[model samples]
Target: MIVYILNVIIMALGLYCLIAKRHIIKKIIGMVLIEYSMNLFLILIGYRINGLAPILLPEMNRVQFSQYGVDPLPQALVLTSIVIGLGTLALMAAYAMKLYEKYRTFDMSEIRRLRG
Candidate 1:
């Protein structure tokens, strides 16, 4: 419950940053926060209280394992997502550096402001 609330709060803050901030780096940070929050939510949704791992041993009853075991799919999905997110963040950071080199500023508004 508390974890869910914290995830929501973090997501909200990230959204706020993405919507209200002008800096490219800040927007990237916001995107990271949102991604992390979503990953956490997925993991939490698949979690069971007092649950054991989904691994099956030869001695364990299949029915009992099915009933008490935790879901492993979400965990796998989150791991993939984290890897993708890291690659995306690295790409975004590289773009930011390129943008800074061309524009001499990190502020998105200032870099793209209308010239009149």
Candidate 2:
């Protein structure tokens, strides 16, 4: 329940950043936040209380193993999400830098030159 609340809060923060912030860089940061929140929510969905790593060994019992093992799918998904997020963040930063160079400001409203 607590984790669900936190996830909701994280999503709300990202939405607020997207809606209220005026800087292009801020919008990119908001996008990153949204991505992170989604990853976190996915991880939380796979979490078990007092869960153990799903490694099979000679000492492990089959029943306990199945009951206590952590889900590997979410971990894999989170890793992919993080890699994609890193790539996206880098691209956004580079774009922001170019925007700054051209407009000399981070404010989105002030950088509008192609308005039609």
Q: Could you list the CA RMSD of all candidates, in the order they appear?
A: 2.4, 1.9
| Alpha-carbon local distance difference test for all models | 0.92, 0.88
**Residue 51 lDDT, candidate 1, scale 0-100:** 87
Can you tell me which runs of candidate 2 are displaced by over 4 Å?
A: none
lDDT of 2 by residue, 29-66 (tens): 88888998899888889988999886799988999989
Which residue pairs in model 2 clash with each other? none
Residue-level lDDT of model 1, residues 5-95, one tens digit each, is: 9889999999999999999989999999999999999988998988878788889988888888988999998999999999999999999
- Model 2, total clashes: 0
Instruction: Judging by lDDT against the true structure, name the best candidate.
Output: 1
